[model samples]
Structures are given as C-alpha cells and as structure tokens.
Target: MLKLHFAPNSRAQRSLWLLEELGLPYELNRMEFNPKDLKSDEHKARHPLGRIPVLDDGDVSIFESGAIAEYILERHKNGGLKPAVDDPLYPEYLQWFHYCEGMVMPPVNTIVVHTLLLPPERQDETVRGQAQRLLTRALAPVNEAMEGREYILGDFSAVDTMLGHAIYMSNRLGCVTDEMTNLKAYVSRLETRPAFQKAMSA
Candidate 1:
C-alpha cells in the first residue's frame, strides 16, 4: 500500500485529493503543520525540506505535489487524468500541469508568506500588495483561457487538482478579486467536485 505524510491545509491536500480521485487505498500519516512535527529528523528523512505531501510506495519515496501527482498517474495508467503522449493534448496538459506551481503559486506563496506566515509586525503590506498585483497578472491569462472552458483542458484532470489548490489558496488570501469572474466561476466549478471537497476537508 502507498503511504502519505500529510498535514491539513497544506499542499499535501493535493496528493490526498489525487488518491481519493484514483480510489487507491493508501495509508495516511497525518502530521501537524509546525516545525516541531515537520522539521524532526524522522520527517526530514522523508523530505530534506520537511515538506508535506511526501509519498512512500514500498521502497520509492518522493516529495512535491506535482511530482507525486504524476507518479500516481503514471503508476495507475494515468488514472484517466492524463493525456496520452501520442495525443496532441498531451503537450498542453504538461504545460498547464506545471504552470500551477511555476507561474501561479510563486505569487500566491508570496502572498501567503507576507500575509499569513510572517509575524504581524514583520509582515509587509507593501510586499503583499506587490504579490497581489503579480498574482493578478499571472492569472490574467488563465482567466482568459477559462473563457468558455470549464477546466484547464476542457476536462477535469490532474492539472485541475494542482491549479485548484493554488486558486483556492489565492481566494482564501483575498487575492482573487471580483473582476476575476472567469476565475471565480472556475473556482465554483472546482469547489463542486467531490474530490476537491474531500481533499479540502482533509
């Protein structure tokens, strides 16, 4: 059986959602989202950075949600979540799958650090504002792409699981503004997914 080291309200939720979507039986090693729990030697052994969403499958251990999601799909024959390499959509799939972490999450994480992670006195509103602007700019293309599309690739795929988390995080941080109607609608569609709901509850 697969085993996952998870923490609530962390990127690990993406892995959990993937597992649920795949209906794969796995062990959940839930941990606290704090240094005492994540920074311990035991946890560090699984991930040098002590990050959540570390997956253990027999002798194979891996970290990072994007890699984990791909690992799961590759092992499970894409689990109907990935486009076949021969298919033309495969290239686009790969782009959007990585885009969540590469383009969107940078600013989203910046906002998180400046707004939630940093101490109140140390938190910089200026930094947060800049991140908000960057986030808006980063999502503009996505908003445009979302026009007349329900999902990133016009079908719910693993990419949605990854991007959904970033969008959800941005929304929670108030970085998702009212003018982002397309994104707001996209969020609504993602929120209605049972897999997304189950993951969020975790």
Candidate 2:
C-alpha cells in the first residue's frame, strides 16, 4: 500500500490534494510541524531532510511534492493531470508544473519565515519587505497569464495543483490581493474544488 507521510499546512498538502484528486487509496501518516515530530531517526530514514509529504511505496521512497505528484501520475494510467508529449501544450504544462517551486515559492517562503516562523529577535524587517516586493514581482506574470484564461493551459492540469498551493499561501500572506483580480479568481476557483477542500482539512 502507498503510505504518505504528511504534515498539515506543509507542502505535504500538495501531495494529499493530488492523492484526493486521483481518488487513490493510501495511508496518511499525519504529523505535527516540529523537529521532534519530523526530525526523528525513523522519519529521516524516509527523507534525509525529514521533510513532509514523503511517499513510501514498498521498497521505494520519495520526497519533494512535485516529484511525488509526477510519480503518482506516471503510475496511474487513468490520471489525466499531465499532458501527453505529443500534445502541443505538453512543454508549457511541464514549465508551469516546475515553476511552482522554482519561481513562486522562494519569496513566499521568505515572507513566511520572516513574518511567522522566525523569532522576533531573528526576524528582519528589511528581509520581509524585500520578500514582499520580490513576491509581487514574481506574481505579476501569473496575473497577466490568467487574463481571459481559466487555467494555465486553458484547462485544469496537475500544474494547477502545484501552483494553487503557492497562491493559497501567497493569499494568506497578502502576496495576492484584489488588485490582481485574475489571480484572486484563480485562487477562489482552486479553493472550491472538493479535492482541495479534502486536502486542506486533511
């Protein structure tokens, strides 16, 4: 059986959302967001970094949400989250899928670390402001891309699953706002998905 080691509110939610979207039966090993919980010797065996959303498939183990999503999609023949290589949009789909972490999350993570995770003594106002601006700049193209488009590729794909989570966190951190009406609508659309709801609560 597929066993997913997850932590609520972490990037692990991405994997959980994907699993729910695919209607796959798997074990959810929910964990707390703390070193004592994830940084244990046992957990480290699965992920050297002890990150959440590590998928254990019998003898194989995988970490990284994007990798996990691809792993699951490649295994499920009925999974239509990715585009076929023959499809013209396949290249664009691949671009957006990886763009989630490559472009979007770094600044969002910086803001999150500065505003919420870091202790007051360690938090830097300068870093927070810089992250906010960087995040805004990074999101500018996404807003432009969403103009008159439903999804990144004119239809729902796994890229949405990856990008949606970043938008969700960005919204929470005020990185997304009403001025970006298209992005706001996009986030709202993602929020209403039943699988997304399940992952949010899971």
Candidate 3:
C-alpha cells in the first residue's frame, strides 16, 4: 500500500484528492507544521525542505504536488482519472498537467511570498502588485480556454485536479470574478465531486 505524508490546509490536499479519486488504498500520515515536528531528521529525510505531500510507495519516495499527481495518474491510468497516452487529447492533457506547476505556480508563489510569507517589514508593495497583475494575466488564458468546456480536456481527468487547486488559490486571493464566469463555474463543478469533497473534509 502507498504511504502518504500529508497535512490539512496545505498542498497535500492535492495528493489526498488524487488518492481518493483513484480509489487507491493508502495510509495518510498526518503531520503538523511545528518547528519541532518539521525539524526532525526523519521528516527532513522525506523532504529536504520539510514540505508536506510526500508519497512513500514502498521503496520509492516522491515529493512536489505536480510530480505526485503525475505519478499517481500514470501508475493508475486504468482507474479512469487519466487520459490514455494514445488518446487524441493526450498531448493537451500532458501540457495542461505540467502547466499547473510551470505557469500557475510562479505567480501564486509570488503572491504567497509577498503577501504572507515575508515579514511585514520586508514586504514590497511593488512586488505584491506586480505578482497580482502577472497572476491575473497568466490565468486569463485559462478562463478563455474554459469558456465552452466543463473541464480542461472537456472530460474529467487528473488535469482537473491540477487546475482545480490553482483555481481554489485564485479564489482565495480574490482574483476571481464574474468575468471569469467559466472558470468560476468549473471550480464549482469540481467542488461537487465526491472525491473533492472527501479530500476537503479529510
């Protein structure tokens, strides 16, 4: 069985959601983000940066939300949460899968760093505004792309799990609005999924 190291209200939400969607039997080892807890050598061994959402599958250990999502999807492609490699939509599926990390995360990270992670004395107004603007711009294409579709590939797949997290973050940052109607509806649709609800409540 898979062993997942996770914590609530963190990136680990994505991993948990994926596991639930795949119907994979996995052990959830919950960790709290305390100085003493994260400082332990064991935790550091799982994640050099002491991040949550690490997956220990027997002898194989993995970190990073995007990597974990991909790993799970690939390992269980027959579970119906992923597109087959030869499917016509496979290329777009792979592209959007990676886009969650490559395109969406940078601006999100900037927002986190500028708004919450940095000390008040070190926070830069210019950086915050720039990050907000860039994040908005980066997400505009997604809104446009989703205008006619209920999901990224027009069918549910791991891509939805990936982008749903970004959409959640955007909503939290007050970056979503009626102008992003399709994107907003997409998120709402995802929230209605049983797996997503389970992950959130877990």
Instruction: Note each model's CA RMSD in angstroms.
Output: 1.2, 1.2, 1.7
Model 1 lDDT per residue over 1-202, tens place = 9999999889999999988887889999999999999999999999998998899999899999999998999886554788888878788888878888898899988888887789999999898888899998888888887789888888888888898778888888887889989889999888888888988887
Candidate 3 per-residue lDDT, tens place, 44-83, comes to 9999988888998878999998888878776755537777
lDDT of 2 by residue, 85-116 (tens): 89999988888788789889999999989988
Compare candidates 2 and 3 on lDDT and give the better one.
2
Error of 2 at 133 (Å): 0.6
Decide which is better by lDDT, 1 or 3.
Answer: 1
Better TM-score candidate (1, 3): 1
Worst 10 residues of 3 by lDDT: 74-83
In model 3, pairs of residues that clash are: none
Evaluate all candidate structures by whole-model CA lDDT and list the values in order. 0.87, 0.87, 0.82
TM-score of each: 0.96, 0.96, 0.92
Residue 149, model 3: lDDT of 91
User: lDDT (0-100) at residue 88 of candidate 1?
Assistant: 82
Which stretches in model 1 have alpha-carbon errors above 4 Å? none
**CA lDDT of 76 in candidate 3?**
55
* Residue ranges of candidate 2 with Cα displaced over 4 Å: none
Clash number for every model?
0, 0, 0
